[model samples]
Each structure stands twice: as C-alpha cells, then as structure tokens.
Target: MKLIIQIPALNEQETIAEVIEALPRKVPGFTSIEVLVIDDGSTDDTVDIARRAGADHILRMGCNMGLARAFSAGMEEALALGADVIVNTDADHQYCADDIPALVRPIRDGEAKIVVGARPIRDNESFSPTKKLLQWFGSWVVRKCSGTDIPDAPSGFRAYSRDAAARMCVVNTYTYTIETLIQAGRKRIPMTWVPVRVNRVERPSRLFRGMGEYIRRSVATILRVFVMYAPLRFFASLAALCALPGIVGIVRFLGFYLSGDGSGHIQSLVLSSGLMAMAMVLMAVGILGDMIAANRSLLEDIRARDLLGATTRRRHDATILKLADAS
Candidate 1:
C-alpha cells in the first residue's frame, strides 16, 4: 500500500516547508509514503520551498483557482501516482503533523473509506467565543444536511481511501469540505471521524475575508449541495408552501360562494388559481431535478470504476517488470 499526503498551498512560502518537513516519512500500514504539494498559482516561492523540504510531487496550477479546484486536481494527480490512500492537509500548518497517523489508521484498518479530523473547536484558545459558537452551529447544520455526525465539518484535515477519493465530485467553488461530505452521505459512502490536535497559527485565514463573508459563502454552498443531492425534497417543500396558501384562498372563495356572495369571491378564485399553478410548476421542476441527480450518480459510479481499473492495470504492469528484472 502507498499513501500520498497532499497539501494545497497558496502563498505559503513562509510555512509550506515546515508543513512538508513535519510529515512522517514512514507511516505504518503503507510500504511507501510520499508528499504531493498542490501549488495553487502561488506568486511566492512556495513550490521551491516545498521541493527543498522533500516533496515528492508538485502539481502547479496556471492561475489561482479556489481550494475546491486545487483539491480536485490533487486527488486526480494522487490517484494517477497510484496512491492507495490520500491524506489532505492544510499548507498553513494549523493541523498537527503527528496526528496524520491517527487520520490514516481508520483507513488502514478498513473501518472507513473516508476519515475526517474533528478539531477541538470550543476548547481551542485561538478561537474567539463568537467563532466557537459559529463553528458549533455550522457543524450542527452540516450534520443535519449530511446525515453524518461530523463535529468538524469545515476542517480541511481529512483522509480519503483511493476509492472514495475517486468517486468524489465537488462542484462548489467556495469550498470542497461541506460539498464532498454531502455528496458522500447521499451516495452512502462509509465514513468515520477522529479527534485531532490543531496548532496555533498567527496568520489570518486566506479562505475568506471575515466571519460574515465565510458564513454567507458557506451557507450558499450548503444550499447548493442540498439542492443538488436532495432536489425533490427541496422543491417539494416549496410546492407545499405555495399549495397551502392556494388551498386557503380557494376555501375562502368556496365559503363565500355558499353564502350567496359568489360574485365578490371570483377575485379570490383567480388568485388561488395562480398560486396553484405555481405549485404545479414547482413540482414539475422537482421531478426534472431528481432525474438529473440520478444521472449524475450513475456517471460518478462509472468514473470510479474507470479509475480503479487503471490503478489495477498499472500495478500489474509494475509487478511484471519487477519479475522480469529479477529473472
């Protein structure tokens, strides 16, 4: 088995080397361990620093795409490198490097295909009281949305078994963490979480400008994923909202008509008809969205099979070459 640790770095020249050097060179349950640094169009010397710190692979992007795109690219490259397990961490070094073994242990033991590192949000001294409450609320919302009891939904520290990584398709440009979890939960992927330690980083977050911006972007991502994964339910709820008001209007019109004031109630009937039409339209859209969701699932499955097939063939060819050389 081979493990690849991937760090998506931006302008982290100051700390990228330390993050790379701190990684464990020989982790248990894997014969080879390598580091892959995803340079997301860093204008600094992050790539050079990572290479000096002994990074095995550096996948550089042409421009500064967001973390979601960088993560997707890293996963693709790691899979192509024949990684059995891929561990994604932050270039800011906020997560403890020593905790990586714990993250990978669940994958190695076959307990889960995806493992998330839950941080001590409330107990961390670096987090303000407001930040702590926000973190708790965000995690709670993600749990309800994902159907997974992950206490740290926004934590970037995570490990993905090759198979799980292959099936992951994150479309949200804001962040991949929540979108991926929602996808996995809806897809019924086996997942587990482990507690991990966090280091105190003095630098501000590069992902967002402020708490308000983060909340706005994160909420948008959650809503988008919810719609994508559970479109029928979302639209059905909207339909219900419209239908209830329409029904009330119609009942009011009927009551007036029975009381011999049918002429004045014609306006009420017209309004009710409009609302009912809206309800019908929403339901029709829900049906269409549900069909699209089903097709998306099938395509993901096909992509996963293709990735695994290619990995297997590469391994077979490597084994044949080794045998021939020995003979």
Candidate 2:
C-alpha cells in the first residue's frame, strides 16, 4: 500500500529539517512511503530545508493559508497520487517521528480508519493554567459533540485512511484536529488513539501564547465542530441554555402571582415572555440547521458510494490489463 506522510509547516525554518529527517524510511505493510512537506507560506527557508531533508514531494502555498487549508491541500494531493493512507504530523518537531508506525499500525490492521497520537503530558512539562483548562474543556466539548470518548481529541498527529481523508470537510483553518475527529465520528468511521510521548520543540507553540486567545480558539473550534457534525445538538444546547433562565423566571412569576403578590407581576411576565420567545426562535433555527445537516450527510453518503465504486472499477480494469499483457 502507498503511504504518504504529510507535514504542515508554517515558519518552522529552525526545526523542519530535523523533523523530516527523523521519519522512518521503511515500515511493514507499506510498499512505498512518501514524505510530503506543505509549506504554508513560511517566510524563512522552510521549503529549502524540507527539500534537503529528502522529502518526496513539497507543496508550497503562496501565502499563509493556515493549517487547515495546508493540510487539506496535502491530503488532496496525496489522495490524487493514490495514497492508501496518509499520516499528518506537525513540522514544529513536537511529535516524535518514531511513533509514526504505532500511529499507522491500527489503520493498516483494519482496526481503525483513523488513528490519533495522544500526547503524554509529563509531570516535568509546564504549561499555562489557562491553556491547560482550555485543553480540558476542548476535549470535553469534542467528546460531547462526537459521542465518542476521546482522551486527546485536539492532538495534531493523526493517521487517516483514504476514505477518511476524502470524507472530511474542514472549515477551520487555524485548528482542525478536533473537528476532523467529530466529522469522522459522524461518518461512522472507526477511530483509535495511541499514546505517544511529546518531545519539546525548539520553537515556541502558537497555542501557548495567551489564555484569552487559547480560550477563544478552543470555543471557536468546539462550535465549528458542533455545527459541522451535530447541528441538532449544537442548537438544542443553545436553546436549552437560553430557555432555562426563562423557564425559571416564569415559574417564579407564577409562584408570586399565586401567592397574592401582584406588585412585580408585569415586569416578571414581560421578562419571561421575552425569554420564551427568544428560546422558541433559537429552537426553530436549530431545527432548520438539523435538517440542513441531514441533507448534507445524505449527499456525502452518495458521493462516497460513487467514489468507492469508481475505485473498484479502476482496480478491476488494471487487473484485466495486467492479464492481457501477460498473455
């Protein structure tokens, strides 16, 4: 099987070469392995360093297209080249290349369509408190959205089969690890996680900058995933959050009115009514979104079926051609 290793790099001039060089040259079940470096408009010499490190293919973006777009482009290219499986790793050298085999083994064994490298956070490793909280919250949100128990849903190091790669529709450019998992879960693709040790990188992480940014990005990712995969749950949760306060207010107003206290009845009634109205509106929107998600899923299913049929036909044709040549 053809296996392609894709690394998405953005201004990783200092450590890109080492990361590429560290990849294993050979592995079981893979007849050939190709290393692809996606340069996301790095101003530094990232492209040159990757070329020197013996990359089989280099995809250069004209400007900084962000991680999601770069990754999508790389996966598309690999799929077009007939890669049976693709592995994604960061160019910052945070993930160990030695763990690639472990990451891909489950997929090769037919146990999973996607496998994620879960990073171990050691006691000695220090991260900001806010960053830690965001990570925890993000994992929880992903679990809720995907209905899958993911220990480390935001891990960037992952392996995907051709089916999973082709089926994913990533909207977020900054972060897509969690979103991809949610999408896979929605598509009924089997996924597994393998624990891997995280190595310290030479460059600072973009995710470790500040608490506010981390929280904002994490929330955005969660919401995006919710919309993409489980719009019903997303909208229902919002409606419930909005309507809960109104429900309580209405109950309190009724209690007061029944208790012969009519002084603040008008104000309470107005507030409760307004809250109920907003909740209803949100619920309607959520229902509409759920319908849209259903339609989208049906379309995706048809597309996937057509693609698989085409692939099977091509393989059969190739076999026939080989037999004719032999005769």
Candidate 3:
C-alpha cells in the first residue's frame, strides 16, 4: 500500500526536523511511503527545515490558513498522489514515531478505516490541567453522543484509509479533530485506537493556551459535533433541559391548588409560564434545525453517491478501452 505521512505545520521550524527524523523508515505493509509537510504560512524557515529533513513533498501556503484548511490541502494532495492510506502527525515532535506502524496496521488489515493514536496524557506534565480536564469532558461527550468509547477524541495523530479521508469535509478550523471523530462515526467508518507515547514538546500548543478558552472551545466543539451528526438529539436535549423547571413548577402549583392551599402564587405562576414559553420556543427552533440538518445530510449522501458512481463508470470505461486496444 502507498502511504503518505502528512505533517501540517505553522511556525514549527525548531521542532519540525526532529519530528521528521523520528518517523520510522520502514513498515511491513507499505510498498511506498512519502512524507508530505504542509507549511501553513510560516514566516520562519519551516519550509526549508522540512525540505532539509528529506520530505518527499511540501505544500506551502501563502498565509496562515489555519490547521483545518492546511490538513484538507494536504489530504487532497495525498489523494491526488494515489495514497492508499494517510497518516497525520504533529510537527512539534510530541508523538512517538514507533507507534505509527501499530496505528496503520488496523487499516492495512481492513479492520478499521480510521485509527487514532491515543496519547496517554499522564506521561506529560506540559499539558495544562485545564486542557486535560477539557479533553476528558470532550471525550465523555463524544462517547455519549457517538456511542463509541474513545480515549482521545481530540488527538491529531491518526491514520485514515483513502475512503475515510475522501469522505471528510471539515468545516471547523480549530476544532477539526473533534469534528473528524464525530464525522467518522456518522459515516459508519470502523475506528480503532492504539496507545501512543507522547513527550514534552519544544513549543507549547498554539490551540489550548488558557484554561477558560480551552474549556469554552471544547464545549463549543462538542455542541457543534452533536448538531452536525444528530441534530434531533441535540435539540431534544436542549428542549428537555429548558422544560424541566417549568414542568416541575406546574406540577407543584397544581398540587397546591388542588389541595386548597394556595391559588395566589403569582411568582410561581409567572416563572412557570415564562419557562414553558421558553421551552416551547426552543422546541420550535429545534424542529427547524432538525429539518435543516436532515436536508444537509441528504445532500451530502447524494453527492457522495454521485462521486462513487462516476469513479466506477470511469474505471469500467478505461478497462474496456484497454481490452479493445489489446484485441
């Protein structure tokens, strides 16, 4: 199998070389391996460093286009080069290269379409406490939503078969990792995880800088993933949460009135009425959002089907033409 190892980097000149050097030179199943470094508009000598490290291909962006776009570009290139599998790794030398073979093995064996390198955060003290907390919460949320137990839903180090990679259309730039896992689950792609060792990086993470920001972004990503895949569940949960207080208030108020205790509870009445109204409004909005999500999902399915059919037709036509020429 032809494999492409993609390293998306921005201003990682200091650690990129070490990261490249750490990658294993040979794997058992891969017939050809190419290293592709995507320089996402770094003012530093990241491109030069990547070239010096013997990267087979380099994609340079004119300006910092963000991680998601850089990864998309790199995946497109890998696909164009007819890569059967693509492995994504960080440029900060945090991930262990020795674990790459294990990560790709499941895909090669046709057991999984995606394999994630689950880094044990306990080994590194460099990760902020808040970041760790957010990761835990995010993983829990993903597990609950996707019905899949993932140890590291936000890990950037992962391998995807060409089929899985082709299906991804990432919309979020910063939180693409979370979206990727969620989308893969939605696509019914078999996913497996392998434990990978991680070390302290030379440069700190650019994404999770502060505790509050990290938490906020992670929560937002979780909500976004829920909306993307299961909009009905997301909205239904929101509606239920909003209706709980109102339902409780009404039950208590009615019980008191029926027992001839109190009918002049204006506060309770107002609170219940307001809450019920809010709940109804939320439910209405949820219904609309669910409809939109359904339409979007249908469109995406149709597009994927069309693409697959076109590819199959072209392959058949080419084969027939080759047979005619041979005859």
lDDT of each: 0.94, 0.82, 0.83
> Which of candidates 1 and 2 is the stronger one according to lDDT?
1
* Residue 216's lDDT in candidate 2: 81
Best by TM-score: 1
Number of clashes in every candidate structure?
Answer: 0, 0, 0
lDDT of 3 by residue, 1-327 (tens): 788999999999888999898888788899998999998999999999899998999998789888889998887777766678999998988888889999999999999989999988755677777667767777888877766767888889999898887777787877568888888787788998999888777565787686777678877877787887777777777788878988898888888888887567657978988988888887887788878878887886775565445545665787899999999
lDDT of 1 by residue, 158-188 (tens): 9999999999998987789999998999888
At residue 61, give the lDDT of candidate 1: 90
Error of 3 at 263 (Å): 6.0
Arrange candidates, best lDDT first: 1, 3, 2
TM-score, each model?
0.98, 0.86, 0.85
- Greater TM-score among 2 and 3 belongs to 2
Q: Name the candidate, 1 or 3, with the larger lDDT value.
A: 1
Worst 10 residues of 3 by lDDT: 303-312
Error of 3 at 196 (Å): 1.4
Clashing pairs in 1: none
